[model samples]
Target: MYTGMRISEICNLKMVDIDLENRRISVVGKGNIYRRIPLREDVVYMMKEYVEQEREKSKFADSEYLIVTQRSAKMDRTAMLTWFWRLSAELGFRIYPHKFRHTFCTRLIQLGVPILTVSKLVGHSSPQMTARYYVKIGMNEKLHAIHLL
Candidate 1:
């Protein structure tokens, strides 16, 4: 989920699916495709902490997923949305889970990541979808034509 995986794919993730040594998590992305997402250090740390706590509680003894329910079963999109909505309401923020994904792409574009790369990372099937929000910010040399005119 942190890597912008579709809710369905995230729900299907298993602990063994992640290559923790390589810092990569494999995802079943859009169009039934598969891709590997690099794990950020923060994500790695969070996972480590979660695993440690889970082992201590034995609540996840039989589960091999990063997230588990009270019954130690896989988490579904509905559960995710319910939790997200409740938290957002409490925080008084008009936030949706998907908005964070959009923000992730927007920030990458602002940082000048190539459109193709961002598209791949976000699991967009086409660069066109990725370009929808890459509105140019600040100066563009093309705009210098105005001064010349």
Candidate 2:
């Protein structure tokens, strides 16, 4: 999911919408902006495995949904969060999923990814939103000024 897509966009994805050969998934993001997100090799592999498993047990073989419930219903954000929160509690992590999003941005900045790209990846409206979270952590002016003399 990290290749740059909003949760709603991902939830709307179908198997037919994915370009396996190109390793990209088309997403309809905020403002109805359509874009392709590159998939990591691991993500591609996992998706392939999931699809194959879904195919065998699926009563509706014609269903093109990328993800499905046991009854073959499309997944929604609320159910997704219910699962996430349940798993988080089981793992003893009391954090919200949004915290992971913030951590993702922070780690990307620390890894030297450009702020503009990170902003786009997170589906932020602008770089200013991204900066609001990371800029405080990047402050070193006070320490650097001591050496300027």
Q: Which lDDT tens digits does candidate 1 get at residues 53-112?
A: 864476665687767877556787888888889998999987767777777787887788
Q: For candidate 2, what is the lDDT?
A: 0.73
Clash list (residue pairs), candidate 2: none
For residues 63-108, could you state the per-residue lDDT of candidate 2 as single tens digits? Answer: 6667676565576777768878899899997755565677778778
Candidate 1 backbone collisions, by pair: none
TM agreement with the true structure for every prediction: 0.82, 0.79
**For all the candidates, what are their Cα RMSDs to the real structure?**
3.0, 2.8
Error of 1 at 23 (Å): 1.0
Name the weakest run of 10 consecutive residues (lDDT summed) in model 1. Answer: 133-142
Q: Cα lDDT for residue 100, model 1?
A: 73
